[model samples]
Target: MKPIVTIAETTQPDGTVLALQEHDGRRFLLSDNVQIASPATKVSERELARIACAPFRPIRQPRIWVTGLALGELLEGLAESVPQKRATFYVAEPSDELADWHREFYPEGTFATDKRVFRVHGVDTGALNSLDSPLHGILLHADTAPLHPRGRGFFEDRRWLSVAYDTLQEGGLLAVASSRRVPKMDRNLENAGFEVAYHEIDAIPNARRPKTHHLWLARKGDYTSHAH
Candidate 1:
């Protein structure tokens, strides 16, 4: 086995050291304290994203907010899963190193050549605050679980959840893919006023292990925010 190579490192304001590691054709981005945000070998994470975006009934030219564009698996899944041909993806990824890896590794694939993806780089949920219009769906696959610190207090702060709640068009969907299921995560989404559903998938595709991957689906509301 080849040793893990550190590609890029970022220091959080809290003095946390986050490093991106490459090994066996996969990239792992995480803080020194926890392991999360790996798109290369985290096949289960991709599965989680796919599961989160279920029963898709997107309106015309539906706009999707993808908080994490890890290797563009979710984007690929979304672009393939949705019936609509016209769609736009707002990709919020704070790591420049990761984006570079995406480009170098998958130039003509999911992230690079996809005409629909728009990348946003920020330390936190900077992209979520500014909304030109109500969105049809929002998919979050940040460094870790929703309660993790990678989002710059996105899940830690209730106001951010409210922003998500308000930004969605009625019947819109919000999905999150996480390595582990945090305590009270479902309750927190409920507090944010979303009808949430939970799913557990394999941590790695075709690998034998307990179902550890977590996927949460939250619908905005029953009626369309726009005219029916």
Candidate 2:
């Protein structure tokens, strides 16, 4: 196995250095206290497979928006599973170096090169405003506010939540995953006018071990809220 090499560094709130590492060929973000971010290789491809294949009833090819492009695994999985020729993907990320690293290190056939995929902005996700047109689906994989520090600012701001709500079309979906269980996540989605469903992805058979993740699928229209 090749030794891990440090690529770029960022500072955490506790005055700790967050290091981006490349081991063999895989990249990861680690801090002194914990692993900040990493590629989702541990989770079985089946879990992502289900998400990618989730039924979507779009009038035309749906316009999808994704925040936190990470290593592009989710994007790649989604592109492979969903074959809407008229689809468009809008991606947002905070780090330019991470984006460059993704383009350089990831495989050539990955989702980054897809013509429909667009790198829209390089800014903190908390500052993300409303989308110009309603989106068919919004995928958030970066961080969950109140559940994770990276997303704390977003959870604290109701305005941001409202922006997300307004960006989706009726019957649109907002799918998110968090490392830790967020009991209030469903309620928060309900408060934002979405019908929420929460499930543990790793609970399924043949799922990845030591890779606990919570999947929240929220819809914009008529369904009843599962939160209580």
Candidate 3:
């Protein structure tokens, strides 16, 4: 068996170690010794993009916000799923080193040089409010979201979900995926004004035996105010 070799590494502001590594000619990323992304798991990322952009394909200038840049698979998935030339992708990644790793080690990666992608500071309310136009979709994955302080709140906090709701155009989608089911996720999204639809997809499409992943496609609905 081939051993995994570290190609490069960087320390985040919070002192966690992030590394780019390769094993048997395949590249992947690790955060604090835990694997976050690899070519082997790209099927789930592509599925995330496909489900998020499928409805908005007819819209010529759809704007999408993607949380995290791990190995650029989400952006690559978006490029393949959304063919509109005018579509834009806003990537929210708090770690400068992660972006740098993409550029330095994987220059050919889609998000590394894609003109349609604009890097944002984070996915907090302030960042969401700064957008000039409401987004058509927002793609999120539990393992790929930012690791900065308060970053995880975007997944569970009603207040933050409300901000996301307000940031989207009517009927826009917020697609979130996780390796395992999250209790009360549907209620949390509903509390934020989304019409939630749950789906289970093959994480590793087409294997002798397949494992399913949990995905929630929450679409924004009619105008309403909900207490946070």
Residue pairs with clashing backbones, model 1: 170-225
How would you encode candidate 2's per-residue C-alpha lDDT over 1-228 as one tens digit per residue? Answer: 688788777664545565678887777766553555565532423244357336552334777776655556567666766667777777765555556766765647354478888776532334345356677677765341112344363533456566777777777777766666766778888898888887776633464555667777878884223111
Best by lDDT: 3
- C-alpha-based local distance difference test score of model 3: 0.83
Q: Could you tell me which residue pairs clash in candidate 2?
A: none
**What's the CA error at residue 54 for candidate 2, in Å?**
1.5
Model 1 ranges off by over 4 Å: 8-18, 39-41, 123-126, 142-153, 223-228
The per-prediction CA RMSD against the true structure, in angstroms, equals 3.5, 5.1, 3.7
Write the residue-wise lDDT of candidate 3 on 133-226 in tens digits. 8888899887667653654537797777888999988878899988778889999998888999999879876778888888899988632331
Q: lDDT: which is higher, 1 or 2? A: 1
What is the Cα-based lDDT of residue 61 in candidate 2? Answer: 71
Q: Measured by TM-score, how close is model 2 to the native structure?
A: 0.75
Candidate 2 — worst ten consecutive residues by lDDT sum? 142-151
Ranking of all candidate structures by their TM-score, best first? 3, 1, 2
Residue 137 displacement in candidate 2 (angstroms)? 0.9
lDDT for 46 in candidate 3 is 83
lDDT of each: 0.67, 0.60, 0.83
